[model samples]
Target: MRIVSVRTWALAVFGIVASYASLYWVQANTVDGITPPLVGNLPSIVIQGIGVAVMVYVVAQLGLRQPIGRQWAWLTAGSASFWIGSIVWAYYEVVLEQPVPFPGLPDLFYLALYPLAAIGLFSAVSAFGKLFDTRVPLALAAAVSAVATGAVYFAVFRTIAADAQLSAIEKIISFFYPLGDIWLLLFPAAALALTAGQLRGGRLAWPWWIVVLGYLMVAAADVMFTVGTWDDTYQSGSIIDTGWWLGFSAVAVAASLMLDVQRPRDTGEVAS
Candidate 1:
């Protein structure tokens, strides 16, 4: 770790502790007179606020100095977008004290995160070196996984399109979130592919996988929300919320560790 990383790490630790404590309180305290909004939903806003701020600090502290910097910039944008989504969602739950609508303003921001993150990730990794070495079959597996993810997206979309209760716009918007998240999983599924084989997986090297873990957390929550809500069975403050909280925390922590992550470029083999 770089000596300058102390502050960044401090902020990341705060986010983690805050999120964990908030989540622990929500889940462990089961008692009388407990509403889901107060006990389950409100804390998310607090977590998102801290999580996004930590990431913003990380990006701002580092600035856009290198390819990794550019990648983190986009990642920060992704986290900020999710933070906005959480705020909009909380406005409905905490401020208005009503059921948040599906396919609302929050959904728009939430859907944008995947593309922003994907573009940054692909751009940086591809610039570092060959993202997928044709010499290895892993690239082929990445291809297959991408295809499968796309197939699942279309299948789910078709089902949504057939639903009579939803409007035409709702049909498309409703599926976009889970669709984007399912795409998120593709990153970790082909983790080695993203390591940019040309650098001997040294471009992002270590923290990139942690970032992928963040994607996986959010993506797993996407699966939980999609399936659980199909029958209107999803509950607030459930284990699903932990995925998002932890996901955001992971991103902040990952960005803070960029100092060590970028060290490989100085001495080890690096692509120009």
Candidate 2:
């Protein structure tokens, strides 16, 4: 099957984001009390559902027998976990007409997504283990990680950590999210940096970069969600959610383009 042009996918992604944003506005601004129950809960479910479908389809197309195939397979599972978490989120917000419980079942699935995807990423990076020159690449990664960790700590963890009203469990749950994103972010970044030489100006680079960008979107959305919730301004279908829709859509498109990124083009050293 022929994949569509990147521009086409980009347009489609933008269209989805626009649709989500529109739905969110409708949900937020109810007329005659019509939208608060139904429309309020649809955006996250719809966007995440599409992402999981794309991920599952991509893995199936790539075949599970191969190594990178297995990598995306796990990634698909991670996406599914997040999708399920959204369902639980919508269930409380729309179905039950109650506040969704924090540090709850949904939190379990949401937290699970990071480590699961991290496993997939770790698998992919492990494939290129021999190519790694531990000195320079490792040092660079560590330095960059230090900066990222510090930024996230100040921007996210610090607030959650200092929340006097939260229970010990609540604080722990809140802390888990940004830390999870840190885990998820490290993989694609490391893969890009480590494989840059082999991928030098190659077709494979873009998809990986897109994957990284998708996670950055997810990470950003997570931070925004945390702040919003901290300030009691967050709702499921808010504008901040556009980042998640865009992130998931971008990852799906990247997965579709993985025909090139599943492996390098010319280099034979990095096995699978």
Candidate 3:
């Protein structure tokens, strides 16, 4: 018991350190023309990479200690894709001394995160049974996505890309942000639906809530970044970055808590 308690404490401290360190590094290294050493992109790399590692560790070491399941595997892969995108962006920002290209490797990884994460969340909810059936909840999720996406497009994207000088590629890239945000917003909605009537709740409920919050935070951070980029006012170390730090940290926390949560059913069990 003491050993487990100490290990949990260690994870908490590590998470706090990693989250704040990324924020501090971003703030310190955002100069336009001046280039820092490897430190320039180190913060982004470390934050995302550590986030991936922590999520996997939590799912593997703490999450039931059974063989790593498809749900956790998908989530881990999603984080890894984001980390890879971060590294690619860092290379573009630091080594090349240029902006990351539109529709590039970074974008590929970033885009991949959505479907993978969605699948993972879907799988997680499916474990709780018919709470998230295909008909009502999915229709509701789609309706929510449509409304939210429409509002965001009108309010944010329209204003940002209204310039005549913007090209086809630019418009596409600008659209990607909102699309991704909308897709991510589905997780929490599904999670809420899944746990709606259950009073006592499964062991997995807390972790699911944490993951849901993390996804929502990611969407919120993306929104801020989109708006900030449109206005040309987003800064590297700004408070906007906190969304990601907190979001990823929440995910890590979920992973760590997985062991204490109820074990997820196998794929076959969930499908039935």
Two-way TM-score contest, 1 vs 2, winner: 2
Q: List ranges where model 3 is wrong by over 4 Å.
A: 1-13, 28-40, 59-68, 130-147, 196-202, 231-238, 263-272
Off by over 4 Å in 2: 1-35, 132-135, 193-197, 260-272
| TM-score of every model versus the real structure | 0.76, 0.83, 0.76
> Against the true structure, what is every candidate's RMSD?
5.4, 5.3, 6.2
Residue range 1-272, candidate 3, lDDT tens digits: 11123333455566678767766765577577343546545655666677788777656653443333567777788878877887787777778877666557787887788778767666655664454444554566677778888888788788767877667776777677658757654544454444643534544455666776776677777788777765666544466766776676666666655544433322111111
lDDT (Cα, tens digit) per residue for candidate 2, span 41-129: 67777767877786787688678899878988887888789889989888887778888887688888888888888888777667666
Ranking by TM-score: 2, 1, 3
| Candidate 1 error regions (>4 Å) | 1-20, 28-34, 130-144, 147-171, 188-203, 263-272
Cα-based lDDT for every prediction: 0.66, 0.70, 0.63
Best by lDDT: 2
Residue pairs with clashing backbones, model 2: none
Candidate 3 at 230: error in angstroms?
3.5
lDDT of 1 at 41: 73
Q: Which RMSD does model 2 reach against the true structure?
A: 5.3
lDDT of 1 by residue, 105-174 (tens): 8888888788877777666645644544433434554665577567766755566567687776765665
